[model samples]
Target: MQENKNEKPFIPTLGITIGDMNGIGPEVIIKSVMNPKIFDLVNLVVYGHGKVLSHYKNLLGVDKFSFNQTNNAGQIRYNRLNVINCVEDIEVNPGEETKEAGALALAAIQKATEDLKEGKIDAIVTAPINKNNIQSDDFKFPGHTEYFTEAFGAHESLMFLCGERIRIGVATGHISIAQIKDRLNADVIRKKLELMLKSLKKDFNIGKPKIAVLGLNPHAGEDGLLGNEEIEIIQPVINEFKEKGELVFGPYPADGFFGNSSQSKFDGILAMYHDQGLIPFKTLAFEEGVNFTAGLSAVRTSPDHGTAYNIAGKGIANEQSMRSAIYMAKDVLLARRENTH
Candidate 1:
């Protein structure tokens, strides 16, 4: 956090919504922006309860953290971290569930989403929110993607788990295991793969990306002996993409794809289900991995981990994931602007 002598706002504002208050959201964020190098890349607005963030500033030794409220929505003053605080009647207890924390987190997200739609910010990168605490009957979304889809009324969006070594995009995310077979249609897979490739090219800046498709069963259905998902569901979709000259291959077994012997075959991977992609991804790259939502009008990324409530307010929490998320958002925004020009 740096002062501009007289102080002024920075461009390409990065809107960061604090996740669950009972977790490490504020802790990691405090540690992240304390470096001041962050101000050089993007001006960050910490969307959270002002008190919680103030507590964090003291804990992290950032004596200069300050926020000046603005009358105009776009008229944000960036001194260190601009906080649009939403006060709620919640106790910030570490490793506990409470409605106050939940409501606070939701308000920040909604505000940031509106700002993104209005073009006030170039992108939004979120920290993890507690599902059990925040989810209610009215809040029907399983995660941010569902909520964003419903917000934008978009027909489809893709969830891609990104890592330095590999990236995995799901054909369908957050659905039942049994429903996956029914959902694995050629049109759906083709659409997801298309978005994945486009993301690789435009966001990731890889011109000719190679993507490997993972199978839905053991031994890749063992040529239809163990299961037919490979033959009946996956292969047809993959073959169609290959015929169109995309560098797509597989219906390969998930086990062998991430194996030490076979991990180098592709630049990215298309997984059939949740655990099929996430297990290997987290195993290899959880510390620095990022989650990006594809097909959104604006860029939204997050650290691929949840708020560690048990470690909230502790100075020892890791900032690697949050740091990676910020860098990823900047990278994507720059690439998108370049491509558009």
Candidate 2:
């Protein structure tokens, strides 16, 4: 963790967690940090198996970059990507799942977040982890978002996405469509909206961002013809939030809200559920999209794309999303800093 004293200092210790070893996390991390510009702006602290990083570096053929363990965050070069390896002596096989890799991924995130909570790192950006593997019979958990929320005792965290076009925040995420009916409540909607507004200002650099919200049912409940969630659950929240001086609007129908031409009007959109937000989000921006967890004490982000396992070792995985994730993480860190003082 020791940083180089002679070189210009990086703002925050950007701790990176190599996600599921079986997936594309390691490749993206290896490729993303190779750019000299990345190392110049942030102090990199990576969590994951050292051997896995070695394999990735060898694959990327970065001969000059080396690994060193540090006790203090003062000796590492800001120009050279610094890794505080959290795990060691683990075998890495692409496209193959194992409990050890999954275990290591969680360990890295835990270590990184613990440092962030303790003020060792200013922010954390995670690589993607395979949810299915983590939910195995032996392991009991839903996913990283839920796991981290529980680990930190965070109350009802919000999952939001960042894109080149319109940014999106979700009210209810990572839940089944069937379960969304019971999940939609005025209190939850208001809190998520409040978090979204705060994130727009603090994370996305939006000054008085106007957020367009989507209705729960098709055609925005069609004036009670289709459903009542809009009038009962949604409108109340939106009205109250507007009264609170938040720049928020809608109960806009999900169908007609998207078009290449219509995308530029809104700074952010708040969707009631996952698919409603992600369908338009992935459609509008996929390869370059970044996943950001809003409403956490620590900043966390990841590439919007999933672990493209089929293309793991082919040397063809696109680094755009990972690159975008790092950039967004830095922006959020700066925004958070500006808000504090």
Candidate 3:
């Protein structure tokens, strides 16, 4: 995507939250900021401990990596990586899940969120966090999407997995398979579809987008012999959109849809549940996918994968997804500006 030629050259300041240090968050973050090309697009600021970031810089042996360490975003400089020390100095453990690491992760997110609310930063790109350890009285939500929804004051949010080719959103997120049936309803499905449609038009620059919705059951309930979700609930919603002259179609069998490579036909897709969308998404774009939280008042995104504990600190974790997340945030910020103007 190109910037509007009539508009002034604008660069957004993006805040990066360093997830659990024991994970590959710091490793990928250090690698991403070290590249000089990134500075040409936007100013970078990391929300984490400067000491731990320095430790990882030395561990990775990247001599070119240097950051301006400060506590205030106003002091951030262009063409240099900036570090905001949100947590105190602590031990650097690469692979173990410690309470300290969890605390640090949450601290970075909280500080970044605060800054976003204050307009200290333009957008946020979060690293992977261990959901199990990050749980506390303050963060009782299941994952980032939920926490961000309440934090940013959005009535609803969609877990939209974005790739170069295909983008998929889920109606039900971070829930068990058994609960999928009970959690899904017309209201929830309609809200997710609304978010995806708006995001595609505003954030993706698609004037009119074609959307596909996946069925909850196999063979789309095999004509209601297997299950009635498609016949009873999902189809009614699809028909309602069709009546309004919207380009929405579906209740497609999830297995056959991807199996037949049908995802390429649409601009966006809506899945009934989490695994139904993520499994195929990760398989196709494991190293490049971005998990974007749509329908929020603020811009937020994250790497599609999690903290690879087995490969943590190995310096082998792929930074493509991290890099992609950063670029996506920049793209969305610019797109939003153009739309608002």
RMSD of each: 4.5, 4.1, 1.9
RMSD of 3: 1.9
lDDT of 1: 0.80
Candidates ranked by TM-score: 3, 1, 2
Count of backbone clashes for each model?
0, 12, 0
Candidate 2 local lDDT, 1-341, one digit each (tens) = 46568965337767787888778888887777766677667777777766776887777676765655554344555556566666656888887777777777777777887787787777777888877665554346666667667666778678888888778888888889899999889998888888888888887778898888888998999988999999998998899978978777888888887743455687878899999899988987888998888888778888887767788766677888888888888888888866776
* Candidate 2 to truth, TM: 0.90
> Which candidate would rank higher by lDDT, 1 or 2?
1
Which runs in model 1 stand beyond 4 Å of their true positions? Answer: 1-11, 59-73, 88-90
Task: Name the 10 consecutive residues with the lowest summed lDDT in model 2.
Answer: 68-77
Whole-model lDDT per candidate: 0.80, 0.78, 0.92
Residue 138, model 2: lDDT of: 34
Better of 1 and 3 by lDDT: 3
> Which candidate should be chosen as best, given TM-score against the real structure?
3
lDDT of 3 by residue, 132-178 (tens): 89999889988999999999888999999999998999999999999
Once fitted onto the true fold, the runs of candidate 3 whose alpha carbons sit more than 4 angstroms away are 1-7
Clashing pairs in 1: none
